[model samples]
Target: MRALQQCLTLAWRSLVQVRHNPWELGDYSIQPILFLVLFLFVFGGAVAGSTEDYLSFILPGVIVMNLVFVTVYVGHGLNSDLTKGVFDRLRALPIPRWAPLAGRILADMVKQVLCILLLLGVGFLLGFRMEAPWWGLPVMIVLLLAFALSFSWVMVLVGVMSRDPEHVQLFGFTALFPVTFVSNAFVPLETLPSWLQTLVALNPVTMLVDSCRGLLSGGPVLGPALGALVWAAIITAIFAPLSVRALNRRLMGQGGAA
Candidate 1:
């Protein structure tokens, strides 16, 4: 209970930073607008035959990609805090070791909600609609955020092991770009080569994208949604412990050799 409270306090601290420095939201602000507009206009006619059709097809996928991309911020922020000796100072506090990490992650989740809303607003203007029931839209938003939360441990592991925040961000793009773009985010998997179709079918991003597509635009739901949840479970089960161990290693004064 005490640890949860401490975590919330630190989470509030993370949110407070936005009030002081609003530019921290630049990525959340511009990236969504650019991706939504650019993709809908640039590829819509070729891919889905019309902007309206492509808007429906790509909005949920773009939201998933947006949330996935923001998870890298966890690593970047953690790496920056480490460099500033912030964790070293936090060590003196009588809080649980995981509190600070949990705090930042939770705060990031809140920021993600804002980004998703902003994108949804832009998408609405572009003719996006929720074909699913109104309740299902909020449910989809919650599930998507939970899915994104499962990615936090992976970022925490990368952040703890990286030499610096820039490296963290660099590694983030290299690893995330291929998985996200290569999947069914921007284009239909059926249109891809046979081998790429198989690979896209196996991609967790594809599962999430499909799940989001179903929930928001009305399609097959159960299979991809369950698959995405399983992927989330697998990722968190593997990385959460690894991230905790990583923090322990740092607490014991080991360098970022891992």
Candidate 2:
């Protein structure tokens, strides 16, 4: 119970810091707007036969990409805190060691939600419509956020291990670029060669995007959603404990060095 309070308090602190460093929100704000505009106009007609037709097909996929990319900031933020001796001071406090990492994840997940909402608002303005009912929007948001929260532990681990924020950002973009672009995010699997089709089908991002597409635009639900849930469970299972241990070790190492 005390730990939960500490975690929430730290989460609030991170959010408060954002207000002071308002430009920290560029990943959540400016980037999504650019992606929506540039991608919608550039690849829309080529892929979907028309700009409007492509908008419906690509908006959900773009949201998934944006969510995944913005999560890279989790690692970068942690790296910054570590470098600035924030974690050193936090370690001296009476709070649990995991609290800061957990708190950061919690706070960043909220940022991811805000990014998604902003993108969706723009998407709606661009003539996107949900064929699914009202409840579907909330359900899709929950699923996407859950995935982001779970995947964030991986970012936390990277942050704890790396000293440079840019290194973490580079690693994240390098890894996520292929995952996002190689799958069904931008184009149909049928459009790709048979060899790549298998990979696209097996991609968790593809499963996630497909589930969101179905929830928003109406299609198969159970299989893709369950697949995505399983992937989330696997990621959280592996990375959460690893991140906790990594942060603890990082704290101990920093203490010893001092």
Candidate 3:
């Protein structure tokens, strides 16, 4: 219980930093809206016959893509704290070792929620409507957050290993671009060649986007949703321990240097 309180306190600290550093918020807000508008207008007609028709298709996808991309901030912020000596100060406290990491992740989940809602609002303004039941929205949020939480562990590992925050962001986005763009996020699966379609079908990003589409607009919900969850499980199982270990090693090295 005490650890949970510490986590919340640290989470609040992270969120409060946004007041002094508003540009961080812009990454979550402006970039996503720009992606939504550009894709919806530029490729909508050629891809889906009209912007209205494409809005439904692309909104959920953009949400997923944006969610994945936004996770880079977790690594960036962690790397910044490490390099800036914030974690060193926190280490003197009696709090649990994991609290800082948990707190940052909790704060990240909050940002994810805000980003999701913002995109949904913009999507609605652009004529996107939810065809699935109201419960689907909440369910989708849970699923997306779950996947994001798991995926952030990968970035957390990156943060612990990288020498600086810039490197973290560079590695994060460089890898994510191909992972996201190669999926069915911006285009339909059938439009691709058979070989590419097969690969994209197996891509976890494709599974995630398909799940989001299922939960929001109406489609085969169970298979894609389950597949996404499986992917999340695999990611968490693999990366969570690795990240924690790397963080501990990095902190120990810093202590030795001091």
| Each prediction's number of clashing residue pairs | 0, 0, 0
How many backbone overlaps does candidate 3 show?
Answer: 0
lDDT of 1 by residue, 1-258 (tens): 888999999999988988887887987778878988999999999999999999988898889998898899888888888878888889888998779998999999999999988998999887788898777678778878878888878888899889998999898878889989989999999999997899899888999889888888889888998888899999999999998898788757644442
Which of the predicted structures, 1 or 3, would earn the higher lDDT when compared with the native? 3
Model 3, global lDDT: 0.94
Top-scoring candidate (lDDT): 3
Model 1 shows how many backbone clashes? 0
Looking at model 3, residue 159 earns an lDDT score of 91
Supply the TM-score for candidate 3. 0.99
State the lDDT of candidate 3 residue by residue for 92-195, as single tens digits. Answer: 99999999999999999999999999999999998888999989999999999999998999999999999999999999999899989999999999999998
- TM-score, candidate 2, is 0.96
Query: What TM-score, over all chains together, does every model reach?
Result: 0.95, 0.96, 0.99
* Lowest-sum lDDT 10-residue window in model 1: 249-258
